[model samples]
Structure formats: structure tokens, C-alpha cells
Target: MNILTAMSSRLTVPFLDLKSQYRQHQAAFDGAMGAVIAEAAFAGGPWVERFEAEFAAYCGTTYAVGVANGTVALWMVLLAMGIGPGDEVITVPSSFIATAEAISFCGAKPVFVDIQEADCNMDPGLLKAAISSRTKAIIPVHLFGHPANMEAILAIAQEHGLPVVEDAAQAHGARYDGKMAGSMGLAGCFSFHPVKNLGAFGEAGAVITNDGELAQKLQRLRDHGQFEKYQHEVIGWNGRMDGLQAAVLSTKLPFLEERNAQRRQRAGWYFEQLGGIPDLVLPASLPEVEHAWHQFPVRIPCRDAVFAAMQGAGIGCSIHYPVPIHRQKAYHFLGLPEGSFPVAERCSREFLSLPIFPELTEEQVRTVTRVLKLWITRNHRVKNIAFSGKLAV
Candidate 1:
């Protein structure tokens, strides 16, 4: 109950600490919750509607359709595109399982693509070769908050007359070439999971698109395939965003850009402190892109050992993904043989997500860098080391 007790209990650094965020916005959060409860508008209500409008404007899209979760957002976009059964969707193997889960649940197969070793995003140069006669859609993920090469991807899609779906689940406010993440694709799917840049208090998602017809159909798909209540025109699942989650999102939406700016500043600290280290490869800060930094992922030799040291020192750390999607037990049915996605597979072994939330203080950032330097000095192999696409030896 004392300040000392509170200070002592908090972790020196945490991967994410929503507790601080909630405390900072307690009044607005409480007000939002009270309004939702007072209205008894539990699902698909006014709050959700308001959030969709606000989010659409923020993302620079014509429409934003709220859904139950990020996975549902992706599925609705695909269903709205009329892509399923006998269709294959192209995406990277470096992403979370939800990307592929949405595809499989829609009765479509996921064709894997390698990522850019620098930004960990889908490599647009390799996209053309992955296309097939049955490739109904292309889902390019903005992995770890960096925007994908939207201009190149869009050109390729136009050439092939294929629709592009951006898995912007981790890149809420990221921008590429001055445009927002979700605005470049046919539909940009977002997750408002608690850890995302624009997180809701709980699970929530939205789909943003410029096409009026596709946006309209996506809205219908998320609400049991109805233009209105109890009037189903097509088969759809229960994917409506709840009023409570929407209320929370609306309360937080105003502060998202400010929070994102802080995350950027924190990431700069990482780059400044860790850059040019021969044994450690920092995440890429590519040109013409603004990263939202949902996860500050780095690649280093002896990644697991470094992760253990960080966590052991109460500096929370995790692997972005230790296993690629193609190598997972669930995807064995796809029969994507080993070495199918070399870049993503290599990243799986090396990518370590460092704690880089807006709530993290500058001193905490310094502390993290200090510990990392100590560990890397002791364990990393510096012989003929290359970093950030250049030789460091």
C-alpha cells in the first residue's frame, strides 16, 4: 500500500505493462466503461459504431468494420473477397499463427513466402514467383510493426489483377512512404489485442478498406451476414465486436499517436545503444517508413542464451516466434518441405523481442541496453561478424 512496496513489486523492465497505461487513463477508462454499462449496449452498439468511424479516419481508409478479434477480421476480409475453398493465400512464414489460422478456417490454403532479412516483412521481390492460378489473395504482413513494401506489392497485385490484404495486426499506426499501413491494401486487418499499439482492454479487431462494396460486404460478414438484424443473406459466423471493447478502444484512440511516438523514441534508444555491434543485428530502420514498434525484435548469435540472461535479470524478453508457420505441426498437411522459406526459418532461430513499450522509461531502456551489452560481450562470436546488411569484422 506504500510507494516503496509499489516500486519494489514492479519489474525493472517488462515486455508489456498495461497496468501503468490503465492507471494513467483510469478516469477516461472508467468513464468509458460506465457509459457502456449504463446503456446496456453490449454488442454491435453505438460505441462500436463510433470507434469504427474514428478508426477509419485515423487509418486513412473509407471504411473500418469492427469484428470480434484479429483472426475474424482477416477471415471476414477473405470472405468478402469471395476467396476460399480451392483458393490459396500468399503470406510470410515469420508471422503469428493467426494469419494462417484465418486462411485455413476459410477453407483456403496458405502459401508461404520468405521475408526481407532486414525488416522482417514480406519480400515483394519474391512475391511474383509465389503466385499461382489458384492464388486468390495476397496477405502481406507488416511484421514487428514495420510497414511492408506497399508500392511494389500494389503494383504486382495490379499487374496480376489480384486483391491485396494487409495483415496490419501488429502495425496500428505504422506508415510507408507517408501513407498509413492499412490504407495501401484492399483491406487492412488489425488486432486490438491488449499488447498491440492501439490496444483495446481486451480482444478486438477491425478491417479497413477503400472499396465501398468490399467494406459493405465485410460489415455484413462480421455480423452474421446481415445488412440488418435477423436477415441473413449469406452464411457468416459470430464475429461482432462487443460494445465494451469498442468503448475502451475509443477512449484509448485519442492517445494512440502520442503513445506510438513514445515507442519510436524508445526504439531509437535501442538503435543508438545497440547498433554496429558485430555479434548482434539490430532491427532495420528502413527509409520512408515509420515503425509503430509493436515488438522490438533483434537477431543475435546465441539468442536463446541471451534471452535467458535478460529474463533472469528481470528484464522481460521473449522470442517473436521460435518456429516458422511452415514447420509447425498444424501445417504439415500443406507439405511445405524444409528450406521452403529460408529467411523466415533463419529468423525463427534468431529473432528475440526486447521490451519496448511506451511505458518503459529512458532509464529502463538504458538498463536493458546495459545488460544486453554485458551478455553479448561474454557470449557472442565476433569473428567475421556481419550486421545490418554489412560486414562488421
Candidate 2:
């Protein structure tokens, strides 16, 4: 059958169907919440402690400190490490604003470096140039659930005697050369926002590390820097993770591996169906790493037109980011020009995130690809006709 004929029966594919995920395991969620309510453990208590231990073990780390959100997790880690004013943290500009916000909130400057086109991550080769005498740390984000080049980044950080704080918010089950996403850095920060691979029902985050001292300091930082009740040791904020979010996370933790596998399988299906379309760029994964496939972002010309077409076809699509952080109004004080980070800038303009979730079926994927292919064909035909008209004139 022709492509259009095959897709005549349309399916409405959501960008993320959280309701389906919840319905699949409603009983466990209800039970977990009930236990917390019965014990009156609403704040940071046994439930939070239980989840911290479980998550730490899962990440192969000695300590994990739960916090209010992923941005707080990153902020608390920097605060614990004493990254204050005049200090600069090197990171790429192609991540969520939270990554840079965490550093800026800690009274430090966030230095931006361009990303590598292949992985859309921090280019380790550009690391040295961005580092200055004030550079104290590095925060490499595992953007879109693909782990960054941790080995090279770590080597560079070690040479400079700076610590590495991995922004692993999107990469729960991702791995690089057999090492878990959050385990290779000095400290790894994660977000359990509702849309993440391993999400809590509400806002939650955590920091995992092997250093016992850093862990203790982080624990204190999240709880108003208190060693004991009513005794404040250092200036801190109310960053503690609530027991309800912790309970939700604990209940969902066991199924994360299976869900991640399902996402990977769906990603494979996209690769099979969307390969070799002219002028389309597919995301690339290094052979040494296992991606968690948090967001399947593809690059194509006339992205806005295609995005609108996809939406009209009832296929939910979105943009990972339409503006690079360096060009954001909040960062204008940094004085970065339009082309400061070309790779990230180009990616911002062209990247389109298709529907990708654990519950997305193979048939839904086929439908999305079919609609995308039809748009490409139409776009090319328009360009060809315009070119031919110009030649005849």
C-alpha cells in the first residue's frame, strides 16, 4: 500500500501519556501513599530515607541525599562544595536552564562552551579554553538521556584539580562504558520531575556521591544546615524532599529498568523506519554507551513548518529547546554574541522532539514516521517547483 493509504486510519499520539503509566500500576501507587499517610510521614522522614538508600544502591553510590527538586539538588551540591562568588563552573549551553540556574544561584558564574555535533554534549576538546583561574568545577549534562563523554571530561577535570558534577537529570538508566550516568562524576544530580525516565508523582531530586563527607554536608544543607533539631551549623535553605514524593519514587523505582528497555526498543523502531530520508539528521549514539532515550530529538529543515504539520496530523511533537541558554534574556549580562556557540544554536533552531514514552506502541511510532515522511515529500516538491519556475523565467 502507498504511504498515505497505509496511514489513512490516524492515531492520536501524545508526547507523553503519563495517565497510561499511572493506570498500569495504580494499586502499588495507592498502597505506597496509604502507608505514608498512616505513619504521618509527610516531611523528610523514614520514607525519604528509605528511598535515598534504595536510589543510592541502584546507582552504585555510597550516599544519596534527597532534595525538593532537581534544581535544588544541583544547588545543594554546589553549596556543599563551597562554590561561591568569583568562582566559575564550566558547562555546555545546550541543556535545560536549571543546569545553569543551579550554578548561578550558588553565587558562581556559569561558563558556557559549545557542544559537539555528534552527541550534542560538551566537547571535551573545548574544555581547556573555557577554563580560567577562577574555574572551580565542571557540570556536564547528559542531555536527552545520552551520557556525555565522561571519561574525557573526567580526565580534563582531574588535570585541573576541579571536581565534576554530572547533570544526570534526564539519564536515569544511561551508561557510558559500563559506568552508570551518575556514578562516574564526583557527584551526580538527578531530577524526578513527572516527565523524567524515573519520575516521582511530584517534584523531587537527589544527589549521589561516593564521598562520605560531601554526603553528610549535603544532608545538612538540604535541612537548613542543621546537625540537630533547632541547631543551625551553616546557612542553608528548606530543600528537603517530602515523604510523599519519596514514597512515589520508591514504588516506581523497581520498574525503571523495564521501562527504559521499552523506550530503547521504541528508539530502535524509529531508527529502522526513519533512516535515509534526505536532509534529515537522526540522533547518533556511541557504541560504548547505552542511552536511556528520554527524548527522541530529530533534526530537519523547515522545522517549524514540519512541527505544525505533525501537530495538525494529531501527532504530538515538541521542541527540546528553541533558545540557547547563552542567548536567553536572563544571561544577556554574560555578553555572549549570537554565534558564540554555533552547534548549540543550530540545534536549537532545527531540533524537533517526537512522541517518545515507555507506553508508546510500535504502531504509533509507524504513524508518526509516516506523517513525517509525507511532510518531507511535500516540502521537497515545493522547493523543486520554485527552482524550476526560476530557471524557466
Note the Cα lDDT for every prediction shown.
Answer: 0.87, 0.91
Identify the runs in model 1 with alpha carbons over 4 angstroms from their true place.
1-11, 380-393
Q: Which ten residues in a row have the lowest lDDT in candidate 1?
A: 384-393
Per-prediction CA RMSD (Å): 5.5, 3.5
- Highest lDDT scorer: 2
TM-scores, all candidates, are 0.93, 0.95
**How many clashing pairs in candidate 2?**
0
How close to the true structure is residue 250 of candidate 1, measured as C-alpha lDDT?
92
Best by TM-score: 2
Model 1 per-residue lDDT tens digits across residues 1-393: 322223325546878888888999899899999999999999888999999999999998889999999999998888888887999999999899999999998899999879987688899999999999999989999988999888898999999999899999999999999899988988899999998988888899999998999988887887778887799999877899999999999999999999999999999999888888886888886898998999999898667766766775678888989999999999998888889889898899999999989988889998888877866664444434432221122
Model 2 agreement with the true structure over 314-361: per-residue lDDT tens digits: 789999899999999999999999999999999999999998998899
- Model 2, residue 330: displacement in angstroms? 0.6
